[model samples]
Target: MKWTRDSYRWIALAAGFTIILVGYAMRNTFSVFYPVIVSDFGWTRGSTALMYSLTLLVYGLFAPVAGGLADRFQPRYVLAMGGVVVGSGIALCSTPTSVWHFYIIYGIIVAVGTSLIGITPVISVVSHWFGSNRGGLVFGVLGAGFGVSLVTAPMYQWLIATYGWRSAYLMIGLCAIAIIAPVSLLFIRRSPHHIELLRQKDTDTGGSGTTPGLSGRTEEWTVRRAFRTRSFKLFLLIGFCNMGFAQQVTIAHQVYFLQDVGYAPMVAASMFGVFGVAFASGNLSSPLSDRYGRVPFVIAGCLSTAGSVLLLRITPNPDSAIIPLLFAFASGWGLGVVPPACFAAMVDRFHGRNYGSIHGTMILFISLGGAVGPWLGGQLHDISGSYFSVFTLVQAFLIVAAVLIVFATRPASMRITS
Candidate 1:
């Protein structure tokens, strides 16, 4: 009946995963609300999409600070605070008086809040706990928090239909605070080895019988040296291209895209929900990257994403719904593959005391891409009256992303340029 040190990592993983579900569920709900918000406010499509971009921009900007904070302190403190900020923003969004208000409240405040509890902190902490072997699998598991969207996507639509958008936001916000805040404050550990923590149970000796924390890691890339490395730059660019260009457009607009092609609201949402499941499937399978090399999975994901976009472009409407839905799931799966692989790659090469900061810096560039992608997609769609060009651009970026990872995967020990 006595739990091992290793069991603590799984416990933390489960806690972190559940906490993140609130933030991601809120984020995914945005795409579903994209049309409704625009219609309610009479905003142009580009302007509306710009709101989402702004949120990403803000998320990008604050991500490093969150990363630094988590690196310095415990994830519990950062996440608890993030839950508060995110909850407040969501609740305030219920009564946005104008576009500027929405921009400041949801775009800025919510973005910052989510950043506090976002990928950098959550994944970094988990990575520290999990060590190298399970990195791909655990990261994938963390990402499956996004899979909560499968349930949330439909729930949001139903709420919007029955109670209305305002009520939906209010309810979701309150629940986010109620759930995420206490759980984070109560459960998360920065890593297994915060002195006071390890004293209690020595969980840092990781249940796998390996010492957790920064015990075996070497080649501690200072933030400066990390900046100079080819790998870091490549990683940044890959994130920008993959996450910024491809991911933004897909996450922010896919629901609308389906609706544009004549799919109904609930149906579109349900299909989008299917994508969430696909994302989880991909995460579950991400252990492949851990067993294999991160590069192969990264490359495969890029190709799969390109294929998904191509399918979306060609599919004609309500009739081919199942096909697009399948591709959407594949798209989610592909997305699920790359991040953990990329993070694991970073850990292998750059891990040191400052992994969180380095990852945060990379996230800044990625966020920049994410910040602009949705606006660009929306504006392009508005001007050209089609998404063909957007799809083309996505394919190009993803290919480049794949190529970048090829170089970034170079063994960390070989290159030590300061």
Candidate 2:
């Protein structure tokens, strides 16, 4: 039997989504092992965080190169190589005897591995598989994989409990190989056709605003050229501030923060879970931007997230279960909304030919932020003896991110040649 274009697109979409979900699950779940690794190594929180920071830096730096490889070659091969590197690198961490080893192995090696099949490449490839008219919804589904992984704290905790952290590393390593490698080898594909031209949706009636491209010409851009635009620079700033400060600070320290404030580890994970659920909801809802417009949703999300950070700061009891959950819900919703919207906005302007490379370059900036944020947060905690200064920084970053979202609307004059 033969499959219709519509039928197989959905099937491929599901496979791609699952692959993304699993890939991120392996990467994001590392935080659950944070305390254990520190205790085992007798490393300072700052130093331990340094490893994570270094990893993010390496991942960010390599992301664009990976994107270019995917564009130039076949993405499946990249994904396949990523599975081996990720799995093996993670497994090797089980034996590392020093923090420097971790910095080199988990930090550098794992980061490089994760970069290849990461959001930048996957979305770049998947975009080709779907129609531009449905781009918002398709990418939203893809982004949900990363958002939902935020909820996997319990699973990570259980793995650590059932098997020690070393063994847990081995488990995830094996899973990465078994799951990601096979899926990539069997199910993933390169979309051989050109992307359907973007449909400009009218805000008033949720209908197509105009035909594709500028003045009836399909505009394309290069990664280096996109960096010359005002909007792209603003986009870079938002990515940098958000990833470098807000997200890394939260992910690296929030669990420990909850514990410092009298919450148990499980309770801490629960807060992350709440954030994850709200985040996943946001990802799912972002597709509505197809009708509603991407910028408004991103702006709303940035404001909501900023408000949550402030609320967390002011909360009389970080120990109060209900309050943290409420804050998490709001924070998660905001972050979840921003990613898809931001990604779509980039595609709207700088898409075609070098989109993967361009997206990768953006990821590079975001990675720089991720690399710096965790280490900075850790140092601040050591100096101030509280998360006050760290969250203060997070609030400031969110403000910048919010402002950038407003200006990152597609640049009317931006265009480039391959």
Q: Which has the greatest lDDT?
A: 1
Against the hidden true structure, what lDDT does model 2 obtain?
A: 0.78
**Model 1 per-residue lDDT tens digits across residues 1-418:** 6555587788788987887778877766688888999889888788888888999899988988998898767678889899888988888888986888888988998999889878888876777677666777777788777665555788999999999999999998888889888988877865545434334324543466544564575554667888777788888899999967788888888888888888898988988888878777776677788778889988988888888887876665686577767777778888767877787777777765567788888788888998888999889988997777888988899999998888787765346575
- Candidate 1 Cα deviation (angstroms), residue 230: 0.3
Per-residue C-alpha lDDT of model 2 across residues 333-407, encoded as one tens digit per residue: 887888787777777777775688898988889889988889988788777788888888888888888877777
Estimate candidate 1's alpha-carbon lDDT, on a 0 to 1 scale: 0.80
In order, candidate lDDTs are 0.80, 0.78
Q: What's the alpha carbon RMSD for model 1?
A: 4.7
Scanning candidate 2 in windows of ten residues, the lowest lDDT window is: 196-205
Which portions of model 1 show Cα errors greater than 4 Å?
Answer: 1-3, 192-218, 412-414
Residue 255 of model 2, lDDT score: 74
Misplaced by over 4 Å in model 2 are 194-218, 314-319, 410-418
Q: Highest TM-score, which number?
A: 1
